[model samples]
Target: MAYRIAARHPGRLVTYTAETEEAALAKWEELAADGVPFEMTDADGVRVDDIDLEDRIDARGDGDA
Candidate 1:
């Protein structure tokens, strides 16, 4: 599934696309780390909130396995 990440400024919109959910969440983490406000959506155009992304990120758990 495709995921879209977007951030809107007063007069501009910035967007990024990811082919997988993991990539999308990574992008979300990057943006959050940079203190950028953004919105993420699934292929079906369903919004994915920060809390949901955070949960998924936590589940991934640093890939030490």
Candidate 2:
């Protein structure tokens, strides 16, 4: 999926997408390579769920698999 980048600065750079984690990171690196300074933010952080996070009980070794 391509992500839309909404930087703090307007008209500098915006709106991008990456198919994978590597691609997304590459996009940031690409921007950095071009000497562009910007900030990364979660534009839709509240509406998104982090699939990477596991339940605390399961991680603590007290839950059944």
Backbone Cα, N, C clashes tallied per candidate = 0, 4
Which lDDT tens digits does candidate 2 get at residues 1-65? Answer: 33344433345556564444444555566766776655433334422112221232235565466
What TM value does model 2 have?
0.42
Candidate 1 lDDT by residue in tens digits, 11-59: 7889999886678878878888887888899888989966776666678
Residue pairs with backbone overlap in model 1: none
Output the lDDT of residue 37, model 2.
Answer: 57
Q: For each candidate in turn, give its C-alpha RMSD to the true structure in angstroms.
A: 3.7, 8.0
What would the TM-scores of all predictions be?
A: 0.68, 0.42
